[model samples]
Target: METKHIIITGTSRGIGFELALQFANAGHKVLAISRKTPQALLGHSNISCLSIDLSIEEDLEKVTQFIEHTWKKVDVLIHNAGVLLLKPFDQISAKEFEDIYKVNVFAVANLTRCCIPYLQKGSHVVTVSSMGGIQGSMKFAGLAAYSSSKGAVITLSELLAEEYKEKGVAFNVLALGAVQTEMLQEAFPGYQAPISAKEMADYIFNFALTGNKYYNGKVLQVSSTTP
Candidate 1:
């Protein structure tokens, strides 16, 4: 595999951390961003880890400038940072909904915009959503805000694909199923997933590397039956 400069968010732990590990271990330069730094990722000479909360608007600009100066163009840009809030419909407030959208949608949009000028012809932009965002997926009943934000991300990816296809930049969204991670545990309390975070991360990393070859402007719903 060629050494590519990859940018991934939410790398404090779970899927994002594993994504960084896999790419960096493969000798790729991984620009891992997260609100908190993962201790293990620090030892990798190939990974440049940034501890910045994407929800903050100012931080987005800083990331854009940092990537501009450090890497001329991003080979793979993965918008993997997201927030999950399980709240009943009646109890969901504007602030709660906005907060989730800021991380899951707005931040993704803003960062992608910043990277547009630097996106190479074959660059791939992948957004990590949840199964909750898919129309036919089984809903767990309390992820209205979270799911809606993800749904918006799916649409955003499609729009970007249409807008950038002429430039050869591919955009896609992955509606991921339940994975055993801290976020999953918090959202579905006590639930066990059929797959681990590392497993999902491996699949995502490989898919991000080549999914655009056969697909773009598509939402690939990846799921495993849960008992």
Candidate 2:
């Protein structure tokens, strides 16, 4: 396997952190971005952690500069950063929806667009969506903003895949099920998931590495029906 230059967002914690660690451990150069740099990534030679708030447009400069100077090219770009707004649809304010969309949808779109110059043929872009985004899954209450934002992410990625198909840049979305991560814990306190963050990270890492051959423009729903 070729050593890849990978860019991952939301590496401050949870599945994003796990993905960064897995990539670094695999000897890939990982550029991690989050609102704040997580201690676990600090001082790691293989991992370059950038403190960038995706919710703010101004913070994207740091990422742009890194992609411009550091690698000059990227093998994989994973938009794993997301914000969850668990509230009744009627109670969800416009501001709350905007916040979630900023991180979950717009951030992914903007970053992917900006990184096009850095993306060579055979490169891949993966967006980490939720089961809540796609319909026909277990409908949980209080996820209007979060779910809708993720839904838009899926649509955006599909369009990107077609737009870049000739360039060989593939785009895919993973609608993952419940995992034992901070996001899941916060959304459903006291709920236990058989899948761990590390497990999901491993799957995502492998997919990001080579799944593009047959999976471009696809939305794969990953859920454990182990009931």
Candidate 3:
């Protein structure tokens, strides 16, 4: 298999961390971005970690510079970092809602823009979304901000796909279901998810590489149960 240069965000833990590990284990080059770089990922030669808040506009320069100086190109870019705000709609503050959009929506757009010059034909851009973002899907309380932000990214990816279609770069969204992670635990206390973070990462890893061949501007609902 050809070694791919992959950029993944939210890699400090959960599915993001597992995706980085799996890609590196398969002999691909991985740039893992998060607020904190995990000690475990440091041991892998194939993995490079960047500690930065994606919500910050200037912090993204570090990522673009790294790609320009090191990889010179990107085969896949995964927008996986997201902030979840689980609070009553009536009680959620304006700042809190904007904060979630900063990371979940604006960051994705900013990072993708920075990556456009580096993305070549056959490159894929995958945005990780949530089932709650899907229209007519099962809605949950306390996810007004989170779900809406996720939904925004879904539309963003679709528009991007259309804009970049002629360039041969593909854009897709994965609306994931319940997965056992720190985020899930914090969001729904004592609620056991049917799938593990590593399992979801495995699916995402494969899809990030080859899904563009069969799909573009598509949103895949990767959930086994209604959430």
Per-prediction count of colliding residue pairs?
0, 0, 0
Compared with the true structure, model 1 gives a TM-score of: 0.96
- Cα lDDT of model 2 by residue, 1-227, tens digit: 67899999999989999999999988999999998888889878899988888877778878889889888999999999988878899998888888888899888888887789999999999999988888667777898888888888899999989999999999999998888999889978999998999999989989999889888999999888421
Pairs with steric clashes in candidate 1: none
In candidate 1, position 1 carries an lDDT of 62
Can you tell me which runs of candidate 1 are displaced by over 4 Å?
A: none
Residue 29 C-alpha lDDT in model 2? 96
After TM-score superposition, the amount by which residue 206's alpha carbon in candidate 1 deviates from its true location, in angstroms, is: 0.8
Per-residue lDDT for 180-226 in model 1, tens only? 99998977788989999999998998998998898989998878772
Q: State TM-scores per candidate.
A: 0.96, 0.97, 0.99
lDDT of each: 0.90, 0.89, 0.96
TM-score of 2: 0.97
lDDT: worst 10-residue window of model 1: 218-227
Can you rank all candidates by lDDT, best first?
3, 1, 2
Question: Candidate 2 — which residues are off by over 4 angstroms?
Answer: none
